[model samples]
Target: MPWFPEFSSAAELARREIRIAGQADPVAQYFTALNEGRTDALEVVWPGEVVIHDPRAGVVRGHRELRTFVQDNRSWLAEHEARIEIMASTVVGPRAVVELLAHVRYDGREVPWPMAVVAESPDDRSVVFRTYCSQWPVDGRRHVRPPVFEPGHAEPGDVVGRHLGALASGDTESILKTFVPDGYVAEPIGPDYIHRGADELRSFYTGTFSEGGGIGLQNCTMIDDGVRCALEYNLIAWGTHAVPPQAGIAVYERSPDGLLAAVRIYDDVEPPDSR
Candidate 1:
């Protein structure tokens, strides 16, 4: 017997059908198929060129790989008794970022898994899914993830460009200058590991630079929706140690004065010595 039951009512089935037929938003349709474990419905919405960059499974391209990936993911979720609770979603143009809490019952205990997914549509017929999350909840350990996309240059005039510049320069004051006094930064582990306010932010960055003058960013993609800029990059270097670059994404929200108001990061990148 399947853990998620099939649609129970004709009206519900009708709604699902309508949604799968592209009547609803693409991102919503994708999540619907995932939550309901409906591969058929997924096929109706996904184009032939669909690509999935999963943290655990890696990159899966086309319908065949996607089907297998979805099935495997569904099985894993079921095995852990997992349910997704969407925290927030930000849609800018053809890109959508969704933040979710994966509630799972495992090892006779329950835990919340923090994760985020970015969906980008190049055309109506092609879509890319990039997932970001910590692996600790799933396996009781952390695993390094490969870069999802290649790095590109940041536009010199943008806020992200400025932040990167400050970061690379190891100028703590310059980095802090890019953020509002009340801004907060949430590291990849989760919301509870956030560094809030100027004092906390100063302490965090000071230590970061002390270990390494600056870190290198590769394969950078920036998505801006007026209010926020989402940057996906490979964190290649930290401090003195040069380890394999790992995948990470950070969303930067700007204050009214154009300074960074908040930064939420999602990744499983470990310390240099750990590598």
Candidate 2:
């Protein structure tokens, strides 16, 4: 069995103890098919509700709309079977958050994405509504968060200095260990995009560091408003295969543990002018 990480909260731990009961029942089978693309099974859960947030296509709501959404991609899901595994689950109050590993296979190729589902029900027995999900990556640099780190925990300048120090040493882990799980990051590059979670975030760093160039930060500043702190810094990219380092401004939101829950990067590092 693949090792699924556990949670520190006892409430979360208790939820994990619930026996999945037995082998997947008909209802479970229906959900599996619905997720895997056999829209035929969707009717089983229909009359209830369904909403899909497609990163590329945007948000889709209702079973009829969902059916249209799925039918529109029948050729896609039909090509493969996607497996969804629950990695970690926690139930608090009437809400249960489940972290999942969704393995997607298409034309014999597989891509795994991590997703979070927040299910809320009047009773703790069955799920009525669920929202939120994303493709998974190994690093956490891709996500950013709103500035929410409480002040007094650490000076913004100190936080900025620490980030720069991490870059100077190429200590990727320490740098990322500073952010919260739902953290956000806004990239500076033209295809401007927002990244959330640690896995995709790591990919951002891997790409930056793998460029065979030494990177550094400058002109860093920090600002906090009770809930989170934003660490703003300039990124210098230059080295072998060295193009001039584009100067970037980064903002980070810190968690209670001092990890970042959000980050934003803005800059213009255009290629050197060629005569």
> Tens digits of per-residue lDDT for model 1 on 121-239?
78756778888988776576778898776778645356667887887767788888889888988876655678988899999888777775776667477777777777788988787
lDDT of 1: 0.75
Model 2's C-alpha root-mean-square deviation from the true structure amounts to 14.6
Return the top candidate by lDDT: 1
lDDT of 2 by residue, 1-275 (tens): 33334334554454334213211132343345455555544444343555543433456666666666666555454555656676544444444444455566744556655544443434323333333332223222233221111222323444545765665665666667666777766654312366677887777665655545346444433334434343333344432343432323344545677666665444334322330
Q: Model 2, stretches more than 4 Å misplaced?
A: 1-30, 33-50, 70-75, 106-108, 121-275
lDDT of each: 0.75, 0.46
Count clashing pairs, candidate 2: 33
